[model samples]
Target: MSFITDIQQRFKKGTIVEKLIYVNLGVFILTFLFNTFGFLINYNGNFITDWFILPATFEGFITKPWTIVTYGFIHTQFLHILFNLIALYFVGNLFIQYFTQRQLLSFYFLGTLFGGLIFLLSYNYFPAFTDELDRSYLLGASAGISAIFVGIATYAPNYQFKLPLIGYVKLWHLAAIWVLLDFIQIPGNNSGGHLAHIGGALFGFLYVNQASNKKINFFDRILELFKVKRKPLRTVHKSKSRKTKPTSKSTKADYQKKVDVILEKISKSGYDTLSSEEKAFLFKQGKK
Candidate 1:
C-alpha cells in the first residue's frame, strides 16, 4: 500500500483519542520536515520567536486570531510535543471510553479557549506579568490536556489505574494530587501556565456536568441554526383526537413523586434539613 494510504487506514482504524494523538504528531513531524536544516522559508515573514500566542499584543492577537487555536498545534521543542502526545494518547484514550467523541472535542477546544482566556487575564491583570519586559508568550497543549485528565478523573472518581509500584489508585486521588502539585508549583514556575491549567480544568468539569443535564450542547446549537425547520401540522386539533394514555408510568410522574417528598420534608422541618444528596436531587429535578 502507498505510504499515505497506510497512514489513512491507521487513522480510520484508530480510536477517537488515538486519531487526535496521531494528528498532533503528524503536524509536528510535518513542521519539522518543512523547517529541515533551517532551509525552509517563512511563509508569513514572522520569525520562529514571533510565532506564539501573545494575548497582550493586539497586533499579534488580531492578525493571528487563529493563533488561539493553532498555538496548541505548535511545539518548538521535540520533547515538548513528545510528552504531550504521549499523555494525550494514554489519558485521552481512557477518557473516551466513558465520554462521547462530541464531549471529548468540546472539552478539548473549550479547554483551549479558557486556557487562552486565563493567559490573557493573568498577563494583563497580574502585577508580575503587567510589566512590558515580563510579559511572555504562550505555547504548548499542556493546559488543555490537563483539563482532559482532570475531567475524566472527576467524572469517574472510583475508576482505578495501577502503577508499577503503587497498587490500583482511584482517579479522584490522582486528580487531587495533580491539582495540588500545580497549585504548589504555581508560585515558582510558570504562573500563567498554571492559571491556564485551572481555567481548562474548570471548563472540563463544567462541560461534563452540562452534558449530563442536557441544558445545552454548543455544537448541537450551532448545527441547529443551519438545519431547516419544518412547519407544524396544519391538521392539528381537526377533530380533537382522543388523548393516548401512556402504556407505562411516565418519567414525569416518578420525578413529581420525588419532588413531593422533598417538599413535604422542607415544609415540615426546614430547608437546611435536606441532606446534600437530597438537595442535589431536587436541584437536578428542577432543571428537568
Candidate 2:
C-alpha cells in the first residue's frame, strides 16, 4: 500500500509527458495480463482487445467511434509500445520546452484523430486496400508520437541530437527520414498504418508552424469547453517586513553575459555537456 501510494504521489508530481507514459504503460500492462489469462484458458484474447482497435471499414468504425482515439493507447506487441514510449519520452520532453502541456495533449489527440480519418479513407477508397478493408484494424501510439516528433523537428529544424555512432544529426534530418520511410512504405504491408503515420506527421508539421505564428488553436478551445471549473481558493496573508535586493544595470549585464557564454558553450559542445544547474538556468530563461 505504501509503495502504491508513493508511486501515485510521484505520478501526480510528474510532468505531463511522464503522466502520458504512465497511462500508456498502465493500459498496455492491463491488456497484456488479461490476454495472458485468456490464453491460459484456451480462449482467443483478440475478441476483447479488438474492440479498442479502430476498424478500417466505415460500417465497423461507426459501431466503435471511440476506438479512433482509444486505439492510440493500446499496443499488443511489446516492441511496438517500447519504441513508441521511448520516442514519446524524448520528443515530448523537447516539445514541452517550447509548448504548453495543454498544447501537447491537443497535438497528441488531434494527431490520433487525423490518423484514424486517413486510415479509414484510404482503406475504403484506395484500390490497394479494397480486399483487406473489411478485416483490417489500426492500433498503437505511433501516429501520435510521429506527430510530436515531426512537430518539434519542424519548430526547431536546426536543433541537434548527439546520436550514438551517428555523431550529430539535425532535427529536420531525422524527421525527414521518418517521413520518407512512411511515404515509401505506403504500398507495402501495413500500408494503412504507414499512411496514418504520414497523416499525423503532416498535421503536426502544419499545426506547429501555425501555432508558432500565434494562430488560434480551435481544438484546444473545444477541450476547454469540457473542462470542469474549480472554485478559487481563498487565502489570508500576514504582512511582514522584508528586505528586497534591487538589481542594478551592471548585475543585469553580468547575468546576460553569463547566459551568452552558456549559449556559446551549448553551440560548441551540445546540450548534454551542461551541468544540471546550467540546464535549469537555461530552462528558466526559455520559460521567460
Most accurate candidate by lDDT: 2
Scanning candidate 1 in windows of ten residues, the lowest lDDT window is 230-239
True-vs-predicted CA distance for residue 24, candidate 1, Å: 1.2
For each candidate, how many residue pairs have backbone atoms clashing (under 3 Å)? 0, 0
lDDT of 1 at 285: 46
Q: For residues 78-144, could you state the per-residue lDDT of candidate 1 as single tens digits? A: 8888888888877787665445555566567667767777777767777776564245666777777
For model 1, what is the error of residue 202's alpha carbon versus the real structure, in angstroms, after optimal superposition?
1.4
Candidate 1 at residue 125, lDDT? 71
Candidate 1: stretches off by over 4 Å:
37-59, 132-135, 212-288
lDDT tens digits, residues 32-148, model 2?
788888889997765447688899999999999899888889888899899999999999987765556766777788788888889999999989899998889899888988888
> Which residue pairs of candidate 1 clash?
none
Which 10 consecutive positions of candidate 2 have the poorest summed lDDT? 228-237
